[model samples]
Target: MNGHQIGEKVAVKVGTDMDEYSKPVELEGILKSKGDLLGYLNATNDKVGEVCTLSIGNLDVIIANRGDSFITINHFTRAGVEIEDYDVIVVKQGYLFDELSAISKLDILAMTPGSTYQRIENIDYKNIPRPIFPMELA
Candidate 1:
């Protein structure tokens, strides 16, 4: 329980796989990824209009759209969802934090442990034979 209520509705910008969008295909006379059938029915399982369930804390967030360019804040506004309506919005892109901060009062930067972006000084590199640069000073 990370302090989130059971039925809280918060906006979030989460990461999803884009492998299907990168595949080669043709649709409506134009050659593009098969996922381009955004407004069309009976498309792939991950079509734009499709919805997915994302469980965060104790709450379940419904992802209404999936596309290549939805990471931008403008997309959310265009989709009729106001950013200020939610208590917390979790975004994965670090660059987006700057833009979202203009609307929200507080912004936090959190990185997963053991990820590539984690602090190098905190890692115990037992295999390395030589001392590294700033890691040694830290």
Candidate 2:
């Protein structure tokens, strides 16, 4: 069934072992905006209670709302390992509005990388927390 049709309560498999599974949990969230690439979910007032299970592929990611601005994800079976971040996380749901237009813009930029893009060096990168993986690495 499609994600939207799954409704309030649904059974989701958790853990590598098929035997270990979480009970059918109630899913709650507002479908704030439906973007082609990602569906923005505002879980600020979601009645998730304590924790909710999210199935990405075969992995079951446990998510819990810590407050209005933050949500925490506890890596499966890793007690101490928790990932907490802003609630506005991108949850990829689908594709973009105009694929061709998007590609053309990127292609044009790529053709004139040096001429089109300018760099400002010697800035304090430590001030802000880099969101993406590569940005964090840099």
Candidate 3:
């Protein structure tokens, strides 16, 4: 199966051809914070540069580096609400630019109704257990 389908379940090839399955998951959360977009102007900060942080459910995901035409969803695991990169199983899909235009234009300020950036450092996914398919920290 292709990675784009919203609820499609598929087996993802992990390191050294070990197969692990993950479903295409989507959560409607807010754009919590947007880092300095200009940081990407220099090639040196390419992949490490973060463009936006999305609050999906109780999880905060960092969408790094702007100027790309698609949004990549990756499989991941949480260690007490902290997201660990090794858990990322696959790039579910690359959302097309036009398709995400409206979402991209979202009012980021709305995410921080009262608090500041320092107060909202990470997504609270602690309730979710590790090594489970289709489940994130609660």
Which candidate number would show the highest lDDT if scored against the true structure? Answer: 1
- Per residue, candidate 2 scores C-alpha lDDT tens digits across 95-134 of 2234323323232222211211222242234566656355
Clashing pairs in 2: 36-95
Per candidate, the number of residue pairs that clash is 0, 1, 3
Cand. 1 TM to true fold: 0.37
In the range 25-73, model 1's lDDT, one tens digit per residue, is 3211111111121332223323355333344554334344453333445
lDDT of 1: 0.42
After best superposition, candidate 2 residue 31: deviation in angstroms?
Answer: 16
Shift in Å, residue 84, candidate 3: 16
By TM-score, is 2 or 3 better? Answer: 3
TM-score per candidate, in order? 0.37, 0.17, 0.22
1 against 2, candidate with superior TM-score: 1
| Candidate 2, superposed: residue stretches over 4 Å from native | 1-49, 67-138
Candidate order, TM-score descending? 1, 3, 2
